[model samples]
Target: MDRLHSDPGLLVCPDFTNECYCASCVPFISATITKEQAAESLCLVWVATNDDLCIQWCHQLAEETCISAKQAQAAAAAEATHLHQVHQLEEEMAKADKQKKNRFKHTNILMCPCPDTNEEEAFVSDFVLQKIDKGHFIEFYYWTNIGLEEALFSYSTRDDEGLIPSEQDGATVWISAVASKPSKQVVPDRFLSPVDFAQAVPRVVAALKEHDWPNQWVLMLARFWVAIMTHQYWNSNDQIAQQALMIYQEEQQRAWHNAVVLGNGAWDLSIISNTVLGRLFDHVLCES
Candidate 1:
């Protein structure tokens, strides 16, 4: 990235499957990269489109990394975990499943950070957490935005739910999944343009750095794509650019959702504000 950032003349080939005829091509360039590396590369391709090379590269990276069986599985599991608890609660509310409804209330509240910097501020957001009958578990965060409640994050356990011990530091609350969604509304209908987004990246990054947030290259790239895609973008006519744009958006949303889920409520909007998506959210969600 240091090399890519410094050298504007460099070209990124989205067709990683093709032969590299250039003599300057590095060995790692042709070899299969790790998921972490793929995540970072994915961001580069998206930003590189500001030049002319990113469209195909973004599409190819999304295909090779985010759509791979392992990555897709991870994303599916995360989303499924969030949905399961939600559905389970709905069934109970409707009195649809009487026998199962009486089953142990496995739901637990995993506490989360406050909307602002003060810990004393009530952590009004609610999360649905459950260990499935299959012996696995899923965790999801729920928050209100745009006058509606939406799932903020979803996580599926890669390890056994039974083996993992309870969290030691924070208080745990028990809430029925049937709880209302608009408890403490935060998000509002928001939108941004490509140019507006481009201008905000620097400020957001600076704020993140000052706050000592996790702004690692991979995390940053993934989050940036998530932010840009979470809202609308200025339209374009290039077919390749459009295709890659769509896939990156999908990949980033999954990445952000999974990261927050896996992080166990460690993620918050303050940290998100440092990302590319944070900038978009600021324009759309936060009041000036």
Candidate 2:
């Protein structure tokens, strides 16, 4: 045990020390590394945890997001106050759980996604990566509680040159660039099972080669979608999730972060009113 603890490669979370979780999940270190690199991966783990972890993890992620957003002027930069508010909510959640110390072991176990690496980058193409920098493609648009008509409307208007269409008719359309929001709908509720993921791999590959959609954009969306899908399955299947948690906890010091994509609820309809896409939308939907 001492020799394993001495290993430089291992990372045992403070929460998992003293036989709390385990010491074998060293491999999950790499998985956690990848999550840190990509905003989308962070978002997946953020949404998967309970409220207490969500608040704790989100603060760490928000700091990262704030740094990245400032560099790129990404939308998350403006949400500092919002992040603070979330942090404040933590006290409330913490107070609610009176037996916090006793529950820490089990709670920590469920916080992280399954340790296996289902690299989103693998599902994307080099062509897409070469064209889209991580900063630009990290965030995109998604709608909340949208009806079928709104979904169709958003998709149908994508081709119009001037009108920057809102993602939904009456509901909120979220931009994932912010730090405190959840990607509930964007990350599909239902994901492909293990068997289905294997079977669908070929089809996802074919889409990379054949789809006329903006190659890089589609690829970005696909990666996040697939990550969440696989994670969803892992979260539900006790055997895999438990194995992953055990292996990860045994070897390294663990820290949790929420990668839930947040949105700045500020709406600006004028963006569509002024842009060329807006004019194009006028021609197609209004003038036509």
The alpha-carbon RMSD values of the candidates against the true structure, listed in the order shown, are 33.2, 37.6
Runs in model 1 with CA error above 4 Å? 1-124, 128-144, 147-170, 179-223, 226-234, 237-244, 252-288
Q: Which tens-of-lDDT digit does each residue in 1-288 have in candidate 1?
A: 211223333544354333442222333344576444554565566556646534444555666675597888998999999899899899877764654476446322212212233322212222222221111211111212211123222112212222323332365544424232232433211222343333333333333334344445334543544454443332545433333443334344455556665765433322333355344334443333
Candidate 2 worst ten-residue window by lDDT: 251-260
For candidate 2, what is the TM-score? 0.17
lDDT of each: 0.38, 0.35
Per-model TM-score on C-alpha atoms: 0.21, 0.17
Native-to-model Cα distance after best TM-score fit, residue 182 in candidate 2, in Å? 31
lDDT of 2: 0.35
Clash pairs detected, candidate 1: 190-284, 227-277
Q: Looking at model 1, which ten-residue stretch has the lowest summed lDDT? A: 132-141
After superposition, the stretches of candidate 2 with alpha carbons farther than 4 Å from their true spots are 1-192, 229-236, 239-288
